[model samples]
Target: MDTATLQHRFQTLLEQHRKIVFKVANTYCRHGEDRRDVSQEICAQLWKAFPDYDEQRAFSTWMYRIALNVAISFVRSNIQRERHAIELDESIDIAIDDSTRVHETDENVRALQAFIEQQDPLHRALLLLYLEERSYRNIAEILGISETNVATKINRLKQRIREHIA
Candidate 1:
């Protein structure tokens, strides 16, 4: 397809799955300015990678992989991220999306948020997908890990969360 046609289709896909980008940015960044920067970078990377997107596969899954990678790299590359990093405090309940779990108590929610906030980028991505209630297969696919590895890591993360919340 032509450039305009590709851009149009890409924009439509982005609009439909834009929440994936926002959730990633909000989860990865602490401030509005950083979130906006990460979100813009994610959009640009997504557009640059769009031509290689496989139509036979799911767009949201593809988008998540790209967004998470971009967010991870953004955090890793930004010296300012270190300056803004807050220790796991009571107010650390950063909601990932509107679908944030309501069943968990506020204390548990804060603990969970704090736990997720402290993870390394790969673990953060893994937990992000896991918490989104994605299937193990999808998590593995997005993170490029084996299904067995996803289950193992999640089990380990569960234990770590127990340790963290203790």
Candidate 2:
């Protein structure tokens, strides 16, 4: 394919699945600045890897794989930086609090988000995709796991959520 054609195709796919990108960024980042940074990084990585994408495969699945990887890396780097900051400022009490927090749609959504936030990164991704109504095959493909494994893990996650909710 020509350069223009490939670029157009990528752009179309991105427009169609842009929510996947935002969802990933929001799921991983607690701060607005961090979310914007993560979203930009995911878009950059997606553009970089678009040329090599296999057209036969599902576009959202491929996009999810890339977005998830970038988001997970961002989380890892953030964790490292936070650890370093804590070590460096063990005695400091810097309180530059902001009162500009955005409200969620409702209490139930906020509660669910809080619960998911407490999960490990992988499990968090799994739950996010599952709640988004991804099929077992698509979730497996996005997560690079077997369909059976996806089903099993989702079952366990559902049980855990039920227990917590109860």
Candidate 3:
């Protein structure tokens, strides 16, 4: 494809799947500036890979793989630098789209997010994708795991949340 065509396609796909960027950033970063930096880095990496993206595949699937990979690497590097300490600013509310999120005041949802955030990074990514209503196959594809593994991990995460809330 020509440069113009590729640019148009990339723009459309990025706009459509932008939430994946935000979700990954939110799951990985604790502060606003850090989340913005992560989100920017994810976008940059996505653009770098755009030429190699196969048009026949689902855009969100491809975007998730890129975004998650970037977020995971960014988080790992930050963890090493910070000596594995994470600071949560509960007062700074992270906005979730109305379609995916319950009322911010809902205690159950708040507790669930808190629990998910506190889990291991991989499990946190799994829970984020699960809560986003991604299918088993999609989650597996995004995480490079088997469908059965995705199911098992999701079930375990759900049970962990329940145990914590109870």
> Tens-digit lDDT track for model 3 on 1-166?
8999888888888988888888888887877788899899999999999999887888898898888888888777777666235554556565678455445466776787678667777888888888779999989988899999999988888788889999
Q: lDDT for model 3, on a 0 to 1 scale?
A: 0.81
- Best-fitting candidate, measured by TM-score? 3
Tell how far residue 27 is off in model 2, in angstroms. 0.7
TM-scores for candidates 1 onward, in order: 0.88, 0.82, 0.89
lDDT, ranked from best to worst: 1, 3, 2
Off by over 4 Å in 2: 81-107
- lDDT at position 104, candidate 1: 35
RMSD of each: 2.6, 7.1, 2.2
Q: List lDDT for all candidates, in order.
A: 0.86, 0.80, 0.81
Cα TM-score of candidate 1: 0.88
Q: Which candidate has the top score in lDDT?
A: 1
Summarize candidate 1's per-residue lDDT along 19-66 as a digit string, tens digits.
899889978887778889999999999999999999999998899999
| Residues 32-129, model 2: lDDT tens digits | 67879989999999999998999899889999999999999988777866521212112322221233343454455455666787787889899989
